[model samples]
Target chain A: MKQKTLALLTLGIIFGGIFLTMIVGAWTTENTKTPARYTTGSAEGEYNPEDIRGSYTLGEVSTLFDIPTEVLIKAFNLPLDTNPDTFKTKDLESLYSIVAEDIEVGNESVQVFVALYNDLPMVLTDTYLPTQAVELLLSLDRSWSQETIDYLNAHSVIVTISEDSESDKDSALATNESKEPDAESTETNNTTNNSTSTTTSTAQEATTAPKTEPKTEVTTETTTEHKEPLIKGTTTFQQLLDAGIEKAQI
Target chain B: MSKLFKNQPKTLQKKLSIRHYVQFFFFALIGLIAINHTLVETGAGIPFLSDASLHALCPFGGVVTLYNLATLGTFIQKIHMSSSILMILIFILAILVGPVFCSFVCPLGSFQEFLGKIGKTLFKKRYNHFIPQKVHDVLKYLRYVVLILVVYVTAKSGYLMFADIDPYNALFSFWSDEVSVKALIVLGITAILSLFVERPWCKYACPYGALLGLSNKVRIFKIKRVEATCVSCNKCTTVCPMNIDVANKTTVTDLQCISCMACTSEESCPVPETVTLTLEPLNIKKPVSANLNQ
Candidate 1:
């Protein structure tokens, strides 16, 4: 109980616990046949984002997809010297969350990788990219604006030009309609989650523009058998589960 | 309520403990809402209210960041701005008082304290049971070890190594998919132990608590004993959740002192001015009794 004795005992426990966990972890790794959450084995299944956790390293994702290392770094806005193998996906998410919070976005919740995976611009409209682009993405698009998006999708072209050149063309061809997104349509946007929205925003704009087609094909995730009616993205998982979605599909 | 207050003024302590209830309610509600993903998937929404990503203003984040920066020469994550700012805020508060966050604000700490009350009710006089005094003393320092390990492993590896093992994160995130067996086991064990020991996680496991404990040693304001009006009554020590020897020490320099102010409360320490919280340095004595008399 003496302070000196206590201090020595404390140190013993501290070092002992550290040594124990380290040894045990190593031993477990050697003995156990458990697979890593992320590994290069596309034969197993397609890359599903749901399986992604904070433990998955950025290097793993890059390797899995054969994505350029610099592109991944640019997407996440990581330091140049940062070891991709050592840096986890959550690190990028954490950084994005901080920036998101700075912009008065939610607490650490923004999935920045979704943007990278979907091939949207690193940053959305009206925000600085966390880090400067180190390489060029071989895509062809004017600006992210609606008119340019419509024209590009009308031609079904890509964003292949340099950003400066594209932006110059965009200024010349861009429709400067500053109208707010209608709350009814914008607010009702449940199907286009972050990934889906960023990916389909251009195509959707092209089809929706010109107001020529009164009979627009509304792609919905509804079922005819359900009498009470179920909105696809809006229903809580719990409510869905209660409604027997768990028995069928989640 | 009026009749009860008039009959038992001492019960002011119980009434004042409403802050715990508020903290408890806030956490429980958030925990529930976080798990329920209806609002998030339901469609167009303001991103601020619905957060699905792991981590939300946990100060433990800053400790891991410090470790990563020190060990790896880079942040564990690219952006730790929120956590860095949060750590700065908490440390500043730690310097001003002791670990007031643990006692007043931390939902996890509050949850454990509430569980500790259940332990007290079950054990009665034997409620404050611990291991052998020497072993207990040693065991109490394990949190510091956890603190170091969490930082080192997180920094060395590319992940928040403590995430799966963190009881606080586990408890709040049970409804979330992040709940691992390790966290559940630790949380279950700690929840069980809380009935037998007060603030078991804070005293012997939490890395954040270990960091904040330093505030007791160097904080400007301290809980001091005025030996001039000396009384050896052990009421303060008995009430101290961290179990510091409050009565014996002339000034409580124990890093375990959480500044709950229970020792300085009127209900504790029968003699007024015997144990007082003072801003003056322990080296320079103050006229605490005169201030009390006035």
Candidate 2:
């Protein structure tokens, strides 16, 4: 090919490909905003914890993770009147900017909190959670592993609110003292998880306080019972039928 | 005294080559897009204009994120599907006709060439000749090392590590807050060096250029010299920006060839079709020796 022909062809291919992708809706120049979901294993279809970003709003988090908005507001000690819809997770940085040194709380702290609340596995980094979040998690009726309790205990940062004349408060750090989380005292989190799954009103009531009474047997999909069978590779239809599904269902 | 008209009719200014137009088009397009991106971020951009970030438009982002995409099924933050598409298209172009993207599309290469004009005027013949041939030869391979290191680090960290030192981003998105100080410094150094060396960054530090340079060895259409009708005035070699000896080589399989065609018959060669970029290898017959029977 002539040099001129080659040059024009190069431009055509590049710009043409871009144009084609644009037409086909594949040419995205920004992130999808929605976090990536797990594509394989037991967590398939569940949103990946690591894919969360600082741009996510508290309301968006509540919707995506099935976590209550009130619970998130309480966990982070956000202002009662603050709308979760407009509250960006990244705002936590400036909100806690005046906190004591060596212990920082930010978006990663939210990721940690969400992961622990939903019992989703997440890669633990040097992320420190706010003490309120840790306490909120402990107060719920959920069974946490000893290792997780230890992790929460070690990584919690106590943020104290100091209101100014304008009523704008900074989540200030009071002290660096490490306090043990009371995980065993709460029997309501697991019971709440069951009741919350049953009705919207019960879920709202469960978020009000940690119920002390022993609850009915929980039937909601716990982390351990959520795995579904996946047919893969050379698994035949005959084998699938024998395993139990009817031909009509298949 | 009427107007002095003793000199011969002025020659027509040399026509801007197709390659120059292409280069300028991309350079301007990217510049506008980058600026528009900043404007859009502030909620004050032209509604019809695109506001894609430099990383999204850059094919090098696709190259660096290949490992991450393969293992994690996601591009590095800030890079999007457009980069991957451009990367694939450029790869296809490279396999067909060598690294035309470097010469015809990359704004950075065009920017360096623009600076080189000043270098040519100031230094004359001494321009692009300061480096010793042996040292130049060794330094050219450094880009490959850079390519490997960038890919490894980006893969390991699941982030675009190259952005920290990418002079291309620094040049195009200098006004943006995303431009790193190290990248700005590298761009400054490149700009200064362009006054001495031709494509200093492409020859030494551009990881993407290093990746595309490999295409020269196996490109379907190559820069081939017809030795049969060649008047070896060495004009082709002299015009080669990469300092390749195009006059001597029957075929330019050099890794540094950017398919700029500066050394081709259509551009610098005095003899038509002598130094041509063609798909066919030239068929020049060997001369019979007169004293073979002795």
Candidate 3:
């Protein structure tokens, strides 16, 4: 080929390849959607659930809950299947009532989850649900009580709670073993005696007779629990406080 | 006679032209200012013009700055707005003056020219030949594409992309403790390319050169080859730093011509007033003789 002809051919091939690549790129981009990851404690401003992807689709909880699908999606961050306009209007009242009841009872997770389910259209498989739930929980700064922790552990939810606050250190280390039937009554009597001794000690000076009595009561309580090997290993408030400080430094 | 005219032209026995001295003085002044800014411990960083900022002011600066800004938004983001504008204006002036920016103002171009001079002193000639024109022309378009992409990204995402790899920033950054690894890499590449071909970046890679060429076509001051007075020696083209055929055409305003005036110098081409600086209309004169030596 002549040099000019060869140059034109080369240019044609180069441009054609670029055009094809761009078309393929656009097609692929539209088909594949990657779900966004949510993080905790970082949502500093007003909690807009709409900003959280895969939360809610429409206002209707029944059609995903009712109102409009757009409204529900903005408010709750849910995933939905169908168009909001096609949703049955009759289901709106029942879904709204259910959501309201759940919210009043302080079922925040269930309300939010329902909201998300209604709005976002993408199908979140069962495999990814727990991970998403854990992320939502962490972001909301909701602490897990012992019951909640046990439930999550049983369900194999990979949850990581932030380190305990300084003030909660003493209570965290306190051991609560199942009390024996006879031990409960004795414990109540011991608590009454200890309270009375504490009151008297505060009114009197350290050298007075009443001040020494509280020390004896405390010793007596320890001796009763000392008989049990499990109770003997239980940490006191002071010991736990010391351990927390040491741990923080390390 | 040969010993007396070793570095001097046989026709014009002049020590150094006033124009050369003036250019030398201006270069020294700019270099001193750059050094001062680098050394000043005001805890305020070194003040230098970014390519993008330069592009906004002058056609040459604008083209170079635009090209860099398009490719390296992150680097330009750090440049002060005032300095950017000043550099851009300087670039515009350079367009009118035939790449006076590269010869006198552009720190990177000046440094490369200095390096080329050192190479010439050692080797007594150019270390290598120019890249093929076809390949050079194609690669030149890369700067434009890079500029477009960078500008788009910065405009859409509010990012500065070109500031990182601009040679000017790389040179000034060495003094200011603000050298980016990316900028250094680009500078290294430009330097390596320069070793093989004189002013490789200016000839083949500089988008600014392309812009200046446009202004140079209508430039008031231009190198005019008087073919009637010319012997077909090809000496003018041989000594041209930018590799333009200064002896053949009435006007030498090719895109690759940096207006370094090396061809116009007496030592390079021993033709008295053959290639003179004039304000004449372009393409009026015809090619008289072919200088095959070039």
- In terms of lDDT, which candidate is strongest? 2
Docking class of 2: acceptable
* Structural similarity to truth (TM-score) of each candidate: 0.50, 0.70, 0.44
Which runs of model 1 end up more than 4 angstroms from their true locations?
A1-250, B1-13, B18-22, B25-54, B67-79, B282-294
Order of quality (TM-score): 2, 1, 3
DockQ in order: 0.02, 0.35, 0.02
Kindly report which residue pairs in candidate 2 clash with one another: A140-A189, A141-A188, A141-A189, A141-A190
After superposing all C-alphas onto the true structure, candidate 2 shows an RMSD in angstroms of 17.2
Model 3, B1-294: lDDT tens digits are 565446533223345543345446545655555555444423244456212222122223333334335543321222332333344444445444555555544556766765665455444553534566567657656655554555556454332346566665666555543456888888888887666667766765565555555566666567778888888788887777766667778778676666656676344557777776555555566655575445
Please state the error at residue A180 of candidate 2 in Å: 33
| Candidate 3 Cα outliers beyond 4 Å, as residue runs | A1-250, B1-76, B79-88, B91-95, B126-157, B175-177, B265-267, B282-294
Tens digits of per-residue lDDT for model 3, A183-244: 32233223211000000011111121132121111101111212111101123445434434
> How would you class the docking of model 1?
incorrect
* lDDT for each candidate structure: 0.51, 0.73, 0.41
Root-mean-square deviation per candidate: 19.9, 17.2, 25.0
Error of 3 at B111 (Å): 0.6
Put down candidate 2 lDDT per residue, B1-294, tens digits, no spaces.
123223212211347788889889999999999999878745589678788888889998888878868877787667788899889999999998888888999999999998887677667678899998899999999999998999899888766778888889999888865688999999999999998999999999989999999999888889999999999999888878898888999999999999998898888899998988788544577666765655
Q: What is the DockQ score of candidate 3, to 2 decimals?
A: 0.02
Interface RMSD for model 2 amounts to 3.4
fnat, candidate 3? 0.00
- Candidate 1 per-residue lDDT, tens place, B48-90, comes to 4433323434656766767645543333442243445456666
Better of 1 and 3 by TM-score: 1
